[model samples]
Target: MPANKLAVVTGASTGIGLELARCCAEDGFDLVIAANEPAIEAAAAELRKIGGSVVAVQADLATTEGVDKLYAAVGDRPIDALLANAGVGLGNAFLGQDFGRVRRVVDTNITGTLYLIHRVGNEMLRRNSGRILITGSVAGFTPGSFQAVYNGTKAFLDSFSFALREELRDSGVTVTCLMPGATETEFFRRADMMDTKVGTDKKDDPHEVAKAGFDAMLRGDSDIVTGVKNKLQTTVANVTPNEVLAKQHRKMAEPGTAKP
Candidate 1:
């Protein structure tokens, strides 16, 4: 990548997204970081301490307008890296989830993500350079009993990233997918998953997961599954039947499972 090149990272207020932004700043990339919450400003401040110019944009990436606003912040600068990590999750039986919340998950995780990629990827193709890292999930490999929408969206992303990478193989631009398992983040509280086993269980450190992903993106790897346990989970998921996987998911994600 060029010196002082620009990189845009979504969902950058916390967790893996925030760490990914930190990695970019440390690597001396000028950054445009965005998230739906006000904390994005604080994140930008922290990133500035890392010595790179940072711009924070508060945007709901679940909508086209929000995605447009985010890109507008980039102005005419060429983005050297794009971390399409903005996402939302909903936990509960699919039928019991609120329609609005469900729609938000779908829009943020699938529609908005794809829209951003389409706009940015085209620019990268024109320049014949740039790297993209998409945050997918191990959950996508299984049928999530209580996280139906979230997992479904990740499945789409995982599949979409692979296909996009293949199509761009000779284009000089690279696309990589980062598939992480459950991690210590605000995601559980935001998703109202605190009552589930997976939410309460010990999770991977967000920093480690982000490092794994950022490195993979820099290397132009096709995909990376963070954490040894998560790697094992994905390996087993490949051969497991959907029905059995769904049952296994229920044991961890069903409401009240977190109760001692």
Candidate 2:
């Protein structure tokens, strides 16, 4: 809300993360953006043109070292907002996928994410002023038959975000969760799901999703699902049986389900 507020956005190389950073830039917040790829530098360059300082950190945020590196970049500077949107997804049966890849997904989506939150969160609490936005997913509600590990990690994030919100309820800080359905992003491609129906299906726009998230975070709402369809999907998931959900997911995410 001030001229020099700082916002930190992770997984900011592209997609929803990049859009989120753009939102911060447009809102007049200097930014610290991170991604494991070198592309982060390019993203920073793009944001700088919009006005305000933009620092990019190319660190493997799935590791403790990486999280520490990003935090060090902040170096005692007060973070007005922290957008924890760094995460990865993996597709296919858990037993058949590479274990290393699966581990990376877990580490990136949960371990490192929580580590960063713990660090920034304490500072926010100490000052009693800050906003935290966690990028969770509606996929968390179902048993992802083909995307087992990725979905499991999201489930953790969705639940964790709420519990943390409650703990910090009376404080000057607020935590919001952005739960979006499939969107136009590199996610499905990176997950090697190009052949799946969900991967190829028309989805929500990243800019819209990011705007909804950024607005909700500023408003300190509990959570937001980006699209009308997604809102309905998650609501139905709440009542659907896990067995049924898993079957439905298989239809969308199973390998080679993409229409020919």
Q: Write out the backbone clash pairs for model 1.
A: none
TM-score of each: 0.98, 0.99
After superposing candidate 2, which stretches have Cα over 4 Å from the reference?
Answer: 1-3
lDDT of 2 by residue, 85-185 (tens): 99999998889999999999999999999999999999999999999999999999889999999999999999999999999999999999999999999
The TM-score of predicted model 2 comes to 0.99
lDDT of 1 by residue, 1-260 (tens): 55588999999999999999998988889999999999999999999998978999999999999999999999999999999999989999999999999999999999999999999999999999999999999988989899989999999999999999999989989999999999999999999999999999999999899989999999999999998999999999999899999999999999999968
**Candidate 1 wrong stretches, greater than 4 Å:** 1-3
Candidate 2 lDDT (Cα, 0 to 1): 0.96
Candidate 1 residue-wise lDDT at 52: 74
